[model samples]
Target: MIVSLIVIVVIGIWLMSMYNGLITLRNNVANALRQIDVQLKRRHDLIPNLVSAVKGEMKFEQETLEKVVQARAAAMSVKPGNMKDLAAKEGELTAALGRLMMLKESYPSLKANEEVNKLMEELTHTENQIGFSRQFYNDICTKFNTKQQVFPTNIFASMLGFKPEELWELPADSPERENVKVDLSF
Candidate 1:
């Protein structure tokens, strides 16, 4: 009887530890995702300034400017925790920004604008930060998902109502992954 009691106690402790570990992993994923949001917000805030700085100079490229503005608005509308929608919107925004950058080759005047240049540099840096944050979030999500799938932990995770998280991945056929084409001949 004493042996049985000791075994039960041990199992209870192990289950508690597993539950706590899963919670930590889940929180880590949330924190990492917040980091990505911060960078994205910074990038979004920079867009209007960038658009206005080049607006007068790139009259011929109005379509590209409009696309950027529309994408930014769509991206801003996405709520936090909607990873799938956020990824899709972000991909669209990135593609629009890429097209806007390509216009620099066609309009040297835009490239020379000091304010536009500064904003572009800040946006590029924010993009890099977002990329790094995404990688980190994915890593944490993978860890959390793995923990939730493994043998004994899986049983405990499910019982505790812990669900797997979606990773921030661009769709396979997203045009954002495509190279930006520049038409320099005027």
Candidate 2:
């Protein structure tokens, strides 16, 4: 009887450990998402200043600027949803920013302007930071998802409503347009 009781207690302790592990994984995923949010906000804060600085020099690219503005608004207004939808919206915003940067290349004056140049440099740095944050978030999601889909943890995860997260992937053509091929080979 004492042996049976001890075995039961051991099983109970194991289950609790599994449950706590799942909880920590979930929290890590949430924290990673929060990091992405902070990076995105930094990007958003830089946009208007960029747009205003380039507005005059990029007069001919008004449509591109408008698209960036609209896309930013759309991204900002995205409703709470599953990770898949959120990831898709993030891709859309990335595409919009890509277009804005492409448009920037057309204005020689804008490129040379000291203030605009500084803001552009900052924006570029912020974009890189956001990309890093996104990778970090995705890595956390992978960890959470792996545990949630595994054997004993899967059972606990299902019971606790833990679900897989979508990877933050770039939209098709996002990278293609963002980095234009400059044929430097002579």
Candidate number with greatest lDDT: 1
All candidates: CA RMSD (Å)? 2.3, 2.9
**Model 1's TM-score against the true structure:** 0.89
Error of 2 at 34 (Å): 1.5
Q: Tens-digit lDDT track for model 1 on 1-186?
A: 999999999999998889889889999998998999899999988998889988998888899999999999999999877888889899999998888876675677767878878888888898889889999999999999998999978777878999999988998777787776655686
Clashing pairs in 1: none
lDDT for every model? Answer: 0.88, 0.78
Runs in model 2 lying further than 4 Å from the true structure: 170-186
Candidate 1's error at 3, in angstroms? 2.3
lDDT of 2 by residue, 1-186 (tens): 999999999999988887888888888888888888888788788888888988887777888889888777867777765545556666667777777776677678877899988997898898898889888988888988898888867777777777787777765654323565565574
Minimal lDDT window, size 10, model 1: 177-186
